[model samples]
Target: GAGVSQSPSNKVTEKGKDVELRCDPISGHTALYWYRQSLGQGLEFLIYFQGNSAPDKSGLPSDRFSAERTGGSVSTLTIQRTQQEDSAVYLCASSNGQLTNEKLFFGSGTQLSVL
Candidate 1:
């Protein structure tokens, strides 16, 4: 794909259910990030994966949320024990993994609704 691709543009899950969101970044991009935007709130950084180095997960809100990049190409974000407060738009972005490369390609987020 020319740009990032995300699956299940919209998802509605029960409060106790779990959900997994997927993202496929642009080819050759070595840096991938996950973010979420809740109503009336700015984008919140969730996790970051750069090449083979350890992922930066300091931004994750809780232990219930986890993400992983497979083979440095695709990524998945899993939310366990979903809560109403978890409803938001989950976005994925990718970069070239160079400090000089400031541009990022973003995918249209997956809208999550926890009932």
Candidate 2:
């Protein structure tokens, strides 16, 4: 992909339903990250994956939020039993690699709304 692509640009769901958001990252990139941004809030790092490195799950708000990256490229974020508090823009980003100084390219994001 030329840039990151996130699915379901806008999603409206019931308060207890489950939702899956997808992300397709740029070609050949080895680092992928998932983030959430609420109204008037900053980006919250949800998870991070680097080649052959342990995934950093330090930012998941709870067990109901989970994500996975396969073959070091595509990723998915699933929210089980979603809550109204979960409504927000879920963004995905990828960098050239895990080098700390690398710049990140972000996807427009899936705007999930739980009523």
Candidate 3:
């Protein structure tokens, strides 16, 4: 894909269900990130992965939310026992991992609706 690609575009699930969102970063980018945007809110950083270093999970909201990147290219975000508060737009972005020239390319987020 020429840019970051996210799956499903939209997802609707019950309050207690689990959901998995996917992201495919631009080929060769070495950094991937996940963010959340709630209704009328700003983007909140969730997780970040760079090269082989341990992922920075500092921004994750709770233990129920987790993410993983495979082969440094594709990533998946899993939310367990979803709550109404979890309804939001899940966004993915990627960059070359060069601090001096870092620029993120974002995907069209997946809008999650928990009822």
Best by TM-score: 1
List ranges where model 2 is wrong by over 4 Å.
52-54, 100-102
lDDT for residue 19 in candidate 1, whole number 0-100 = 99
Candidate 1 deviant stretches above 4 angstroms: none
TM-score of each: 0.94, 0.93, 0.94
lDDT of 1 by residue, 2-82 (tens): 999999999999999999999999999999889999999999988888974545899889999988888989999999999
Off by over 4 Å in 3: 52-54, 100-102
* Tens-digit per-residue lDDT, 1-115, candidate 3: 8999999799999999999999999999998889999999999999888853445899889999988888878889999999999999999998985662348999999999999
Task: Assess each prediction's global lDDT (C-alpha) against the native.
Answer: 0.91, 0.88, 0.90
Model 2: per-residue Cα lDDT over 51-100, one tens digit each? 53436999999999888888877888999999999999999988896665
Q: Is candidate 2 or candidate 3 better by TM-score?
A: 3
Candidates 1 and 3, the one with greater lDDT: 1
lDDT of 3: 0.90
Displacement of residue 1 (Cα, Å) in model 2 is: 2.1
